[model samples]
Target: MDVELFKDGKRLDGRDVEDLRKPLKLEVGVLQKANGSAYMEWGKNKILAGVFGPKEAIPKHLANPERGVIRCIYTMSTFAGLEDHGRMGPNRRSIEISKVMREALENVVMLEKFPSTIIEVYVIVLQSEGGTRVSSLTAAAAALMDAGIPMKEPIAAVAAGKAGGKVILDLNKDEDNYGEADVPMAFTKSGDIVLFQMDGKLSKEELETAIDYGWKGTEKLFELQRKAFEEEYSEPLDKKLRMVE
Candidate 1:
């Protein structure tokens, strides 16, 4: 718990503070049963997200008459971490994450357009290195878009921190476990902050630096999101165009 996280002015993984782990991949429409779906790999984390509903809200009394309700179900597979992989069902941590994630997505989705229904988003972490929550947010956003859910714009998230006396852009598992402060943030394409959470503490100046890195990181996440959509359709679209030709 007290090992040095930096050496030679670089992270233990040899990344500069602003570097996101390489091989950050995103794909969409990976789940045939869901209305929309996406898969993401960030560092060692692997996540899948699926969207369903905007369908009739069950138990009519709980349905919102003015707008659709956003329900985010965030879960981790038993094998998702370095732990024993024995837990099942919604644990306290997953329940809390699901609540916060639901709030974050509620901001981007134009729920009012679908009135009196439910928009359920399911995000499952298949593996974890760290920052799974923010990665889940990114995948869910893409899945929602894949489902053709109306949104003001795409949403993306990233985790940054102050570690080993430097501001770090993305925290892998080791950094998160030992860092001075961990800050995870979600943002819209236009730079509006949607969700921000912090653990540990930081001076105001350090906090500002983390936020700056967080926003920049989200910009990258948003671009990958766009590519997920293109990856989902480009091949099929090319065949259609060839047929037309």
Candidate 2:
């Protein structure tokens, strides 16, 4: 399939090269059984994340006496893709993503407060257009906050890439396949980098540009994350009932 990534300073999707897709929605406390849960929709991607534990670590040998262990599982649903359904269960790719996600979140969680315990985060992608990893990370952070996990601050993530030899913000599926480079990054609310990964080739200057665009994207996403939490907790029982009525 041929796609025109950039033309007249605008992407094929009619967005400016550095403009991100909007209406990024985040919903918290979506699961009743889980300690904390969040659902996120970014562009064409749909993700759900749940947080469990901070309870005693199972298989005690894995327990950290000095701090709690953070375990993350990132999985894509069989029907998540646009074409053929993805295979069910954890694959090598999923395992690697999970490991990276764990590392990204570990820096912010106050694990020392729950030594010998475990904090489990599960992210499931129900649909994907691109940037599922970053979207999942954002959702996971929201779920962690919903669970009242002690943390320095919530983290947000975004993807930036070079398409048509120009740096673009938040590449969608088409741009991702055709782009020369893709950089995914996660940062704390204070703008501290917690996760950074690059795929494809890029010059030093291009890579730096992509990272700068990623930071811009994350800043916007952080606003949505904060709003999600505020809305989740702000509604009074009576107000909620009134809305339902």
Candidate 3:
């Protein structure tokens, strides 16, 4: 690895082991045509999520008479990476991520309210620097809320891992590639873990530590999710006045 993942007390990005990248930005209602949409930028990662549905389920057979079905599609642009050569269409990795993303949001959605329908979430990674799954999930949750889907609570996700034998919160590209382990987790606002995936090895103690860090990171993420909604609702007076003018 060209970058020193951990040195003295900092990683390649000069953040302490547990510190997430700053200036995580989120915006909602970016797409006019979609039922709802959201955009997120975390460090170098940029992703967009759009939600459509509670509409009729295509193919007919996939619809559940008792509850709505959630479908999630995650895609990475060919130029999303530092290189410009990713293949188009759904690959195995994206397919698997889409499945997990669907499950994470499915639990919180009040699907029973819209029987025989489908709620589709499309996540597009415009740029990537690691932890795209978590970023995508975060944006997906926001998009669902923006779509006015009834939900128990918003979901938040984060990645925590072992680096230099220490459990750290939020892994950037270098840390993820060079670190000893990476654990990505998602939770509801009430702290229910809806998704968890681990890559690499970790001892029992390290695993526990990583989970704790993951929860803490998700708590922060949940706050950001709420902040996005607040900003969405709180239109500035200047903008309103300009509209009036």
Top of the candidates by TM-score:
1
Between prediction 2 and prediction 3, which has the larger lDDT?
A: 3
lDDT, residue 190, model 3: 89
Q: Per-residue lDDT for 1-245 in model 2, tens only?
A: 55677778788878987787755899998887678899999888999999998888998998999999998999999999978755778988899999989999999999989999999999999999999999999999999998889999889999888888888889899899988888888989888999989889889898888888888888888889889878987875221222233
Please give, for residues 110-145, the per-residue lDDT of candidate 1 as tens digits. Answer: 998988999899999999999999999999999999
Better of 1 and 3 by TM-score: 1
- Residues forming the 10-long window of minimal summed lDDT in candidate 1: 236-245
TM-score of each: 0.94, 0.93, 0.93
TM-score, candidate 2, is: 0.93
Per-residue lDDT, model 1, residue 43, is: 93
228: Cα error in model 2, Å: 0.4
